[model samples]
Target chain A: MEFTLIKPLFGGFLLGLAALSLLFFNGRVAGVSGILGGFLSFKKHDTLWRFAFLAGLVTGGVLLLGTFPETLNFTLKSSPPAVMLAGLLVGIGTRIGSGCTSGHGVCGIGRLSQRSMIAVVVFLSSGIAAAVSIDLIFGGEI
Target chain B: MGLLMIFLSGVLFALGLGISGMTQPEKIVSFLNVVGEWDPSLIFVMLGASMTYLTGYGFILKRSKPILAESFSLPTRRDIDPPLVFGSLLFGLGWGLVGFCPGPALVALVTGYDSVLIFVLAMGFGMYFFEGIDSRFQRGVDGGAA
Candidate 1:
């Protein structure tokens, strides 16, 4: 197969393996938002593992930068203000919603949870609508 | 050992995201932009990840408990509440706008881009703000019910 298909499928399989490892070994869901949220809460016993995981995330990025720089290539299409707003919404929304793409889109769907199913539908629809609207408003510039 | 495994899991997950083109905001924006020039590559990412996770999860669940922890600490909440729907909607809007969900945004922090830094800081503040509001809201509900 071509590089395009290979990259996603390979990467996705890696993600699955990561999730499986966490659950099988630690009994924790490999949800980024939840991990970050818990870390922020400052619960002493919980913070250590969360911090380790986050540190590992950064280390992984550094590894990618050194080994496969092309994988990390991309320019931000949105302006600074837009990006900040998006970040805020992501933060609050994930906190209140109890999961993000990793939690709801990947793990949640995998577990066949009805709530996750509903959440995936809602977020996908909202994301599609917002993306289409932004593209239209910016005349495809954004 | 448990912490080490979790850390390794994070590394692996980040690697998957980086290799999958998820670290690129533009790729995600293009994927979400179905009306415009769309990219369907992300669908494969989801499909591959979910199918693998589903099969693996089934096997894992058959075991009585995790190796490190006493028992599985999975979410037990099943209710379809307002917070779930509205929060997801807001999250999706943010995702579509910037193409950086929590994981990718956090993973991209290694780039040291000023934009990524700003987005992460704002996201942290937003999470803190939500916690404050949610706690107060919960208290209000309890008081009213009492």
Candidate 2:
């Protein structure tokens, strides 16, 4: 029960906070997909907003860690080669789709963007399938 | 100021990914394990994101006008369909293969990881490719926003 409650609660909290900050201070949704996507066709001045968004992402993580060192740890469960490939592919997919799970699935859907809503559903289902394939088909933990 | 705000937000997001160990592929893989020796740290990654979004969005919506862009860029669709399912599958497959996503990849970029660079490059290319089809679909959908 403890694990269940805290897990979703914190997930929701981080998302809610990020979303609000973008909406208020920046006048945007904290959709990583859209933000990152814009960088592809970006001009020099366009880099500013993207940079700011990325900076906030990193900063928020640091702030949380600094305040609650007790809640931090560094661990993982994938091979180096596999990890690299996976990273490469996701980077490609996110760019092509113009958003990731957070941007499309979380923010886009919340705002009810037709593209985002569809995108989220696709990515989330893709994610679940990815999980299944890694665990089942691969026969090795991904 | 508007542009600056976007930069700050990105950095904060990167920090979250780096500090929470989400940038580490091993950690993500372990969490996805769910069977033998399941490491639940991934929960923290999710928690970190949820927290930031919850508080960040909650406070921002109270403002009279948007602080960044000319106006809010709202999504303009309201239906669900098959392409949605197919796209998600592709995304998930890509995610499971690599522990990095757009957010975490950017975070890893801060560390100057060679892998992150490759991933980012390919990801950018992918977006360019997909936007074509996306636009095509949009046209079919009456350009109302597909």
lDDT of 1 by residue, B1-146 (tens): 77888889899999999998888888888888888777877888888788889989989989999998899888887778887888889989999988898888988998899889989998888888876887777721110000
Candidate 1 wrongly placed segments (more than 4 Å) = A1-3, B139-146
- What ranges in model 2 sit over 4 Å off? A1-15, A43-47, A55-92, A95-98, A108-125, A135-142, B40-64, B132-146
Candidate 2 residue lDDT tens string, A1-142:
0133454345444554556556676566666756655555464765567656766765654554565432233333556565555654564465445456566655654554667656755664565566656778777554
Q: Chain A TM-score of model 2 versus the true structure?
A: 0.79
TM-score of every candidate:
0.94, 0.70
**Which pairs of residues have clashing backbones in candidate 1?**
none
lDDT of 2 at A101: 58
TM-score, model 2 to reference: 0.70
